[model samples]
Target: MTTLIAEDLLLLLLDDVKGTPTSSYLDVALGGALLLELALAEAVHVRERTSVWSSAKVDVAPGAVVSDPVLADALGRVAERERAASDLVTRLGKGTRDALTARLAERGVLRREDDRVLGLFPRTRWPEADGRHEDEIRARLTAVLVQGLDPDPRTGALVALLHAVGAAPSAVDRGGVPARDVRRRAKEVAEGTWAAKAVRDAITASTAAMSAVMAATTAAAAAGS
Candidate 1:
């Protein structure tokens, strides 16, 4: 089965043994990935920012449709109305990780385990079941980030999302490369012309939005604590 870019990202976010997310912001990253997928299908577009202070907004194309149920649902939500990319990131991303995880589990790429934490809370975990596919994704990331190869659009978008979520550095083996250099390279690729100009704009907007929300949430949690 062909997996979505979002699926590839989830695989990276998940711990192979722990079956839990390494980052707390999985939804934001997955949401950005979904937006990228919609952009690739021409199902959605990001309105240009009128000013530097303005946020990019995402809107659905007229009559846009996708075959995948997950993408289709997200497209329908986008079709409801134009929204700031940041707002859409959280809105579209709500509960999406679970849906994607279930899909991955169905495909046998992950194994679902249900457990109770101290017999008080219910939880689910998705550990690696068939790692071959994930291995391929890691190889692609290594090629682009470490081997200095240019990325195809899909791989490039995946890198951009991983970088956006601050997970790029840990997603693959650095092969003795310095962490800072790896980060710099990932940033360069995220800003590269691997994708169309419009798509690039969407990616930039989506990632910026995700970052803004993540930061705000972090601050809010800190304040609450």
Candidate 2:
């Protein structure tokens, strides 16, 4: 699943760079890398259960009740958080692509120029044409890139909580720190207190709204079929 998601993301990045000069390949590559991280996070969330295992087999863990509502609610919250992260990933991908195009245009690199000498010049030469302009473009791109690439504090915290409930293994390794401990720390970093609850509520509401839309679309398609 990860491999498929990575390939799909690479293709999307390539499409975004299509028609741009080869000289700008490095820029496109860097942008694509950042985009890929965001995409992976989203993909992980969207396909969390299916991607990890064929079936969610819960071990009774010696005298644990399987029909606990609290446990069920916790599981539901995790799913909702994943859905929200997936939605954010889609939004961020579009925003990043659009921002890249706009920045390139502002830098005058979007248009084809007829000057043979300038055409032969390196990519750095064009940026030297207007240092201040290039700086501004870089600044704007950096700001957007940082925001979208990093995990949202709220969601990250929620993921940490889910890890606790599920006893999930940590994706990152820290020596001497147990996986659960690391996840709990991450949750602390992502959520201070009240904000996490608010974010949880928002995710729950958004999931319901999005599910309704998807169901309606599926039903309409089925009717037509």
Candidate 3:
């Protein structure tokens, strides 16, 4: 009998990517989520049917398969979320796409886009080539998290805000540091560590800048109206 771990399932989903900058982060996340859910369901099914499997440990009977309704339902839910995320990525603009491609390019994946078609392209070609840029962006973001970059509250905060507003995962990861520890070190940076202080200050400044931009946009619209 084969045993599977959570990390094993994660790898299976990540493996589906073609190693191109254009892979879909949404798909990756969704797939990973589904795989984890399914693994859980399988574990439960096995536990519940322990007696039957044990009685026929060595018996390979035809049509002796047991259906797991729980896993099936979970899979369906994941599929719906995946579809929604996919739709979101498909609607990104050229600027977002370029930003994503640039991030992948930093990691040695160069994507090129033709003005005649989608107007941009990443170096590596994958399924739904135009959409792969977002995937690459997502990959880069996850890489930052894995590397412990502490992108939040400043860089990570901005990235998170962008993510909230529909920025692709790749762009956020590439452009922002990881946000895990930004808050924890805020006071330390303000009182002592120059590096930490600098990061905190930068985040504050960027946030202010974004807020100003939004305010101006809103004011302009109000005045025009």
Candidate 4:
């Protein structure tokens, strides 16, 4: 099966042993990945920032093929008007991780088990169903992050996305990769100008979006308490 950049990212975020997310921001990260795919497809566009790396807004651009509901829904979020990157992240990524997980389950890349934690609250767990595909993803990422090499456009975008979501350590050093080198290279991919102008803008937009969502979530939690 042809793997998507988002799929690769989702695999990295998943635990090989427990088949659970390694980060709390999996939805945001996955959402950001979907937008990146849209940006690459020209289905979405990020307006140039007024300030350096600030106020990067994403808007639906039309003309790009809407392949699936995931991408379609992502486009819908940006359809009305350009919104702050952060707002877009929260809007587009909301509950999207589960959607991606379901798709993966249908594809046989993962196994889904539905149950209740204490015979009360229903819960779902997707365990590692197959390791071959995820292993390929890991190898590709490892070559770029551990070997100090230039990443292809897609891989570069993945790195930036992971960085934006603060999951680089989880991706690179989880399997004994040198944390320092992995972090340094991952940072470059995230902050580097090596990618196309559109991709770079998309990364910036996603970073802003994740930051905005995290801040909002934090504030809301604090207020509730």
Give stretches of model 2 more than 4 Å off. Answer: 1-195
- Choose the strongest candidate by TM-score: 1
Highest-scoring model, lDDT: 1
Q: lDDT order of candidates, best first?
A: 1, 4, 2, 3
C-alpha TM-score for every candidate: 0.97, 0.23, 0.27, 0.89
- Which lDDT tens digits does candidate 1 get at residues 1-225? 698998999999999988999989998888888998999888898999999898888888888879999999888888887789888888878889999999899889999999999999999999999999999999999999988899999999998998888888787789899877778889999999889987998899889988999999999999999
Better of 2 and 3 by TM-score: 3
Candidate 2: C-alpha RMSD to true structure equals 17.8
> Model 4 over residues 134-224: C-alpha lDDT tens digits?
7777677788888777888888888888877667766753466667667777888788877778878888878777777877877999999
**In angstroms, how far off is 38's CA in candidate 3?**
44
Ranking by TM-score: 1, 4, 3, 2
For model 4 the local lDDT of residue 183 reads 76
Residue 144: error of model 1 in Å?
A: 0.3
**Candidate 3 C-alpha error for residue 136, in Å:** 5.3
lDDT of each: 0.90, 0.32, 0.32, 0.79
Q: What does the lDDT read for residue 74 in candidate 4?
A: 79
lDDT of 1: 0.90
lDDT of 4: 0.79
